[model samples]
Target: MCSHTCAPSTLLQRDSISKCSLCLCTWLNPRRWLNLQEYQSKKLMQDSGVAVQRFYVAHTASEALEAAKRLKAKEIVLKAQILAGGRGKGVFDSGLKGGVHLIKDPAVVGELAKKMLGFNLTTKQTPKEGVKVKTVMVAEALDISRETYFAILMDRACNGPVMVGSPQGGMDIEEVAASNPELIFKEVIDIFKGVQDDQALRMAANLGFKGPLQRQAADQIKRLYDLFLKVDATQVEVNPFGETPEGQVVCFDAKINFDDNAEFRQKSVFAMDDMSESDPTEMEAAKWDLKYIGMDGNIACFVNGAGLAMATCDIIDLHGGKPANFLDLGGGVKERQVYEAFKLLTADPKVEAILVNIFGGIVNCAIIANGITKACRELELKVPLVVRLEGTNVHEAKRILTESGLPITAAEDLDDAAKKAVAAIRK
Candidate 1:
């Protein structure tokens, strides 16, 4: 465990960390799992011996008022319990000034909570439509001596976990990363041994922690590493980690995002799943084991492999056409799935033309062609359909298309296929 030394005079004035170079900021994508709300992970941090303030989760205005009244502190921080940040600058759907506020009057908590609850809160990190604030976290306000960033995440380049710390925090980490990357210091952690003494001390030095504070900081780093490993979390972050006037560091704002693949073992994390968090269609695509991302355009893509799907979209754009969506049928897709993909493409009102680009290696071109033929016959395909088939029973696929006598246009290559798709959309 790390320790901090405080002089009587320094603690009196609440002297904070003065240096900025001791800080670093970075954000990690949990990716597979549903992103957890700040309130959700706050307990995890506190339970692991990381510093966290007392807080109450209120689902209703009355509950918020009651919770605020129960707080020992004269002033409390009311934060909208949303997955995305920028709450301080964000506006509520009810036209509230801020998603985060410092309230001294307990009576006002009800009013503020009323405006936030069931209202949409939009932030830069969220979708354009924003997410609804179903609840709020009301916590005691603190006198922060310093605000610094710290985190531990897997580093693909190093093939292991890396601990990052910075003296500069509280601002957008993205800006810090882009404009002043040198300020951030990272140390690689050993998976076999976990966080070593040297790594924690190095991170402590970077944070400019001294005496007991350095030891405490180092100890917290180790515990955080342990937490990440214990929960199989992809990231554990404490942005704007607060150093109290008493010379004690606390996780003022904490985030722990777990890996989705490990959910089978992480039952607690799995229990936090929120299905409404991501795109519904994308979730459906996941069921088919297909790679798909919806976009705004008229031409739809049906291609094998992600690289070719990207190229198909680019060429469509290059030829003055917009791709309606990105659909990549990975190696070994079922014939029924191809038909279903076609159905999905036609389901989009914006899709005026369907472009099929198949480079059959492990894929059977005949199945693809047959699937298209089946979809067209059964669904009575209204839009123009273009097929560009190559390799692995390519002639048989072409012969099947010929026999079907569907108005499906055949292209010789990718570029020619793109041109035809665009032209078909225009016509």
Candidate 2:
């Protein structure tokens, strides 16, 4: 159930915050980047001489149709480029399901491509500026007889890399764990010590792999572990890693997240980043060097502390409301920083109300209040704003808001602020 793995890195931030809590590196640490993009992922597999589908990325529908014709494949897969999971049935459809409209006809393909490119999938991962379909991939579809899960991830318990294999692949792994838990198996590997032959053989035999396929699987396992070390990857998973009738092993789905801090040493890997599928808010935040993750729900939240931001969201959910985003403004904040945070939070149409919960502590509430006033003076601030300011300079902060004529509701505590924000959205 825990797919999240930590990478190793050493980066010195002003706050020295490690982006990936489990990873050795943070984004600040320069290393290669491995984004969860189909094109880039397939390219990695292709470079390693692994068998994967030949695919073309089309920015327009016309290009998709053209590529489809060139490949001479009647059936094709159209996927919206994104890092989110469950694309097919979820908001970001990979178009792997049957009845997916194929571009057999040139005109139809063009139309579909144009439509998809222009459309946005407002999934739970990115409700703000839903993932835009900037480039659609057109690839030959495969008739998979059986699918398996193959992944090499860091095992904290073993303090090394672990290989996970499951005959139950595709769809939800949790469902498989609940229904048939016996099929999934894990093999520990000490990459520095190299994978033991007996361990590899046992893993292969357990997965029912034999003949040439067993050798191939074992080889792939070794290759994957090597790749993990070479790339300093935290996780590498091929879900429903398929098998052709001829026993040909193919990776169908690949999910990878790089140690952001390792970018310095991994320049070549980081160059593969594709921003086409990212949310607009996230892109904007990255441009300003802010840490933010877009989520569903109506209440937009902004806090000076990460821990407080999470607590605010939990309270909102408990009050029968959802949070729009998780934004941490960090410490030693200023008026301009607070203004920028508000701008990004309000940009999303899903945000019906705004919650400003600042404990202040190291930050002065008066400065944040000034920024809130400035945002109200310049931007729309169409949604109601409920604020709670408790730490530094609370009096001046309240005074600034009272004079701003911002129609803002002030609460002395986080509980009161969260409840008021949720109620504001409901009303």
Candidate 3:
């Protein structure tokens, strides 16, 4: 299940039970969006005509201090720039109390940034190893009179877009949805017509804003929706969409995720991607157009399609074997890709055995066989290897493997392949 703030909705039809559970699970998980850091999200919102706090991004401690000086606010806030949430409560490896801080004196901003920059910040949303903070955001701290939650997301239930809001802001929206589902308000928008003015107004009022403030929030909602469409965003979340002591409405914190499919057209937005936050192996796999996800298991899996990859993992687990990774050699795979995928699998110290499950529809089993033999010889692969090839030139593939005389065990079917791989590892 995805940990995104969006409320979960039924994405598959009940009659489609015969469909692959992997496909159904993929649709249900909404964490596929490309996430941007807080400062980047705020900049996008500010540019989209949505009111946001004044802020500056800095890569160094000196720059952080300079940004705080330039703001000249009586009080300033320093935030560690990591992709994950729960930064306010996150702790730094340096024993620093929190990733976020409010300082009365601008002079101390640099000290805090020194503690944050280059240090790992562990948050509930992040892995235990945590993500390193290479950047910091220095912004004017707001004195809020009220707080609210607002977001625009592509909803499967609506079969289009939906606006979600709540007066209970500055809290986990998922927790809010679970504990008090009635407090959350949703307005489904027709993809063709967009968010209507009446709908915005109704949502704004439902968020507990009144009079001019309601209209102002409504206007902000429309602007957010426009930005969502403009940037091809999958989500635009503004938590603590707040009213200040001065009666002005502003977006205090924001998070935005773009659709990966739109990266070509949204070049500028996609360029902001910080590769440092990504898994090194996953990044390497991306270079070869291979889909790889690491897991905590001993058997490495290589399959052709997404559904088949997942099914392979399931079968391995069912046989009391855990998968070390999910490596999907998507359709039209080349020999080089197969070799590269093998390299990634063997590189993992956890992988004691490897399984190749290919039901070649558009892929050539011969290519996979050639790549495997090439890798086994050149790379001196020490792990036990199990091969299961089906469809399209599988006979030729088998002949090649057999003639190569490699120490590879052949399986008759998926179940046999999974069992052999598991038994080999245990031995």
Q: Which parts of model 3 have CA positions greater than 4 angstroms off?
A: 1-33, 124-130
Instruction: Name the weakest run of 10 consecutive residues (lDDT summed) in model 2.
Output: 6-15
Q: Score every model by TM-score.
A: 0.84, 0.71, 0.90
Per-residue lDDT of candidate 3, residues 1-427 (tens digit)? 2323344322221211122222344421212246578888888888999998899999999999999999999899999999777798999999897999999899999999999999999998788989999999999988999999998888765677888899888876767776787888888899999989999999999888898998998999999999999999877888888888787889988778678889899999988887778778888988888888788899999988766877898899999999998678888788899889999999999999999999988888999999999999989999999999999899999999999999999999999999999999999
Worst ten in a row by lDDT for model 1: 1-10
Tens-digit lDDT track for model 1 on 217-319? 8888888887888889867878877688888878888767567788789888678665566667667776777766678899999988766776888899999
Instruction: Per model, state how many residue pairs clash.
Output: 16, 28, 0
Q: What is the C-alpha RMSD of each candidate to the true structure, in Å?
A: 8.5, 7.3, 4.3
- lDDT by residue (tens digit), candidate 2, 285-396: 6565566767778898888766677678789999888998767777778788777888898888898999988887898989999999999878977889998998889999
Cα lDDT computed for each candidate against the true fold:
0.79, 0.71, 0.85
Cα distance off (Å), candidate 2, residue 185: 1.0
Model with the higher lDDT, candidate 2 or 3: 3
